[model samples]
Target: MDLDVAQVRAFVRTAEELHFGRAAATLGISQQALSKRIARLESLLRTPLFLRDGRGVSLTGAGQRFLRPARRTLEAADAAVASVTREERPLRVDVWGHLYAPTRTLAQVAGRAGTWVLGHGRDLPSVTDALLDGGVDVAFGRVHPPLRAGLTHRLVRLEPVDAVLGADHPLASEPSLRPDQLSSGVLWAPGPLDRLDFLHRFADRFGVRARTASVNLGLAHFLAGIAEDPRRFALLPADVPLPEVPGLRSVPLVDPTPLYAWSLLWRTGDGHPGLDRLTMACAAEARRSRWLEYDPARDWLPEPPPGSTAQVYPGSTPGGTRADAPAP
Candidate 1:
């Protein structure tokens, strides 16, 4: 009997994610639709591919054996399609974490990275789904782990972070402040602490208290909120251009400065030429601008996935390497 490519694709994604809700989201389909596809595939095979329980979904023995060939089948199909339509479309790239302004780094390499389309994603999960669904070719932002299988990422930059506070705040006059010093004030975030991974992690690590703003309008509005309360402070990358928000001051966070990590992510088997050009451009820019420099003794960074190491740019020494850094 012939197999349906869509049904096979659904199984592969669900097997990779092991969560119907997330797998469905990645496929841009409803959970019910995804379940129906998986059920049809299993029915055709006359065997159960997945073992479902209250805890979660997991691949059965048959599924474990089918996964490898399924992925190969999908890759082959993708390659066949790419051969005919690849050149007809420009590479599509997307970014998340707009509040942190991921474009600041993308703009540095866009000119030399070749023709492409840009899109915005709500966050990493949404972007990852788009990548898996072939909705986009590449993505940039902070990539936190447990990233699903069938994807790969490379650390591109580690931006120095600064503390933003009201000009009249007690520590605002200081040339540089330590992470611990910020414990005295509230850590203001653009959204909920659980949703703002970087800020939430920062607060937990540094013993600083974090509070989310009711609404996130934009940079100016967010910073203005901090300026209104002397006890309020926030963190931003050193290079983000601040709007004309009076009484707002950004001071370097020292005694272990926080470094925001940026990474480029894409499907593992994608062979798009634009992917190579973008990676090369990012590597060159990182080298020319020293974007990956890290001094563990003087800098603070979130821990990377176990066994994962930072991607070293050409001409850079191991001493300069950082752990797989995630984004702000």
Candidate 2:
């Protein structure tokens, strides 16, 4: 039987997410519409693909068996279309903040690949949308899990998260600090749900009472919030410039330190020659970068707090590394 590509796409996304709400949200469709599509797909096959209970849905046996073939079918279709329409275009990459490491690495790689440049997505959701819509070829950013169904990502850099504060702050003089030590200051955390979850998870691991102040403002305001008050601090990736402004300084966090993963992601089956070139550059670059030697025993932090309101990541295993690409 011929399967509708749209129905298969919905099925794959739903199976990967196992939550209609999240899957529907990612697909930009209503939950009821997604459910009807799933039901129709099941009707055509004469087999139930998922089993729904109070907790949520799980794939049925037939669904489990169909998963691989469905993925292959979608991939083949994407590749066929790309091959037919293959043309050279400047690859657009998404950049986050003043993270120079990724920028430098991308330049080093993409410079050899004719033309490519950094572009900005309005926000993380927009970045995901850009990737799905083929507006960008690759991205260097945080890879929040239950990732969009058709993309694959791997950690390119692992940097210890640090606290940024005014240099005159009492804690700023310390070379390194523990979570308990940071509890003294009010933490200025991002108001975005994903970022908030990460911050809370970080706080929970060390069992620290972080008096966090939510900031919906952009980075400038967020940093300014910390600078205005000596008792305020913000978490930042290590690569952010020290003394971001003249008065601010970044201090390392230790004694239950949690490393923030900076990842490189792209469409799963994208056969862009520029992407292939960049992948090679990435492999070469990873060999020289310090982040490649992550010791899970030393780097891994404790799980999220007992009563974490955040949704736990569905799959424990990250996507498989491609044979030609660098292992992240």
lDDT (Cα atoms) of all candidates against the true structure: 0.82, 0.66
Candidate 1: deviation at residue 250, Å? 0.7
RMSD to true structure for each model, in Å: 7.7, 11.1
The number of residue pairs in model 2 that clash at the backbone is 0
Per residue, candidate 1 scores C-alpha lDDT tens digits across 65-113 of 8886787677678778878886434678999988789988999999998
Instruction: Please give the lDDT score at residue 80 for candidate 1.
Output: 83
lDDT of 2 by residue, 44-103 (tens): 999999999998899999998877677657666766777789745566678653322346
Q: Report the lDDT of model 1 for residue 9.
A: 93
TM-score of model number 2: 0.60
Q: What is the Cα root-mean-square deviation between model 2 and the actual structure?
A: 11.1
Error of 2 at 311 (Å): 27
Question: Which stretch of 10 consecutive residues in model 2 shows the poorest summed lDDT?
Answer: 310-319
**TM-scores for all candidates?**
0.71, 0.60
